[model samples]
Target: MNPVIVIGVLSGLVFLLLVSGTSFKPFQFLGQGVIKILIGALFLFFLNAFGGQVGLHVPINLVTASIAGLLGIPGVAGLAVIQMVILV
Candidate 1:
């Protein structure tokens, strides 16, 4: 019942499970979110690039990305409304 052995065994089991894909359920959810984040960020960037002369832009960062990722177009619209309210 040595502490070092216990730690080592637990670490090995974790590593094995991860490598065998048994621990991927949570990561799949996170991974899908990452894809959505990238997509949303790109969508925002596209809008800003195409509409910058009109003052249409959204901050590109983790929080915005996560919001857009989780909520899609509604999230972008919400951000736009908030930005307009703050700027006005």
Candidate 2:
């Protein structure tokens, strides 16, 4: 998708890894990853819901950027899945 969204997803994934690197628990890391995905999904929903009237139509792109920027590829994928779930 948009570059910003890609960047956001990448960033998000990186942040997830960086933050989780310190945690000794594997489950905690997985949970953290899941949370990131959920956050991305929620962001997309809100963006889609009000982006048009609020002049935030590029919400998915924005969220992708944020997530990518924070988490990275995996995060982006998770976000994508969330989006798909919302769509279908």
Candidate 3:
């Protein structure tokens, strides 16, 4: 496995779990979580499509941390999925 990809995905997942714990009360914001996940996935998809052209070489750690910090766990999970897909 590519080290860059591995690091990206792992960091993303860790970010997700960490954010999940702090962001919400759990079980109550399920719908919001789903929406966040979808948005995160879309964000990553677009990032992959035009990352180089846009000069957004955003590192995985930074990206994940930012998303987890701002959007919470679900967002991080979505980003993690995209990162794994790209890496594989």
Candidate 4:
């Protein structure tokens, strides 16, 4: 698929959505979820980077990311504990 065509289609969709004046609640929720997931991934990355010295690591995947994203720091702590328990 051509990048230009994809951009055009997306632009058209955005224009239609904007002109329709429809509720964006669903979109907002989805955007927030995506942002949270990205943040979760970042959290995992840093955990791995700094925690490596302590021999702590958590795999970054959909499940882990969702858990971290939805639950925040405590969620990451839970994952770390789980990993430690499994390792031991």
Q: Which digits, one per residue and each the tens of the lDDT, describe model 4 over residues 1-88?
A: 9999999999999999996756777888899999999899889999899999999989999999989989999999999999999766
Q: What are the per-residue Cα lDDT tens digits for candidate 1 across 24-66?
A: 7889988888899998897678767866887877889999887
**Better candidate number, 3 or 4, judged by TM-score:** 4
Per-residue CA lDDT of model 3 for 10-50, tens digit only, reads 99999999999787666667766666655655565556566
Comparison by TM-score, 1 against 3, better one? 1
Indicate the residue-level lDDT of 13 in model 4: 96
Best by lDDT: 4
Error at 74, model 1, angstroms: 1.0
Off by over 4 Å in 2: 1-24, 54-88
Clashing pairs in 3: none
Candidate 2 residue 17 C-alpha distance from true site, Å: 26
Evaluate residue 53 in candidate 4 and report its C-alpha lDDT on the 0 to 100 scale.
100
What is the alpha-carbon lDDT of model 2 when measured against the actual structure?
0.65
| Highest TM-score scorer | 4
Pairwise TM-score winner, candidates 1 and 4: 4
lDDT of 3: 0.62
| Model 4 TM-score on a 0 to 1 scale | 0.72
TM-score of each: 0.67, 0.37, 0.32, 0.72
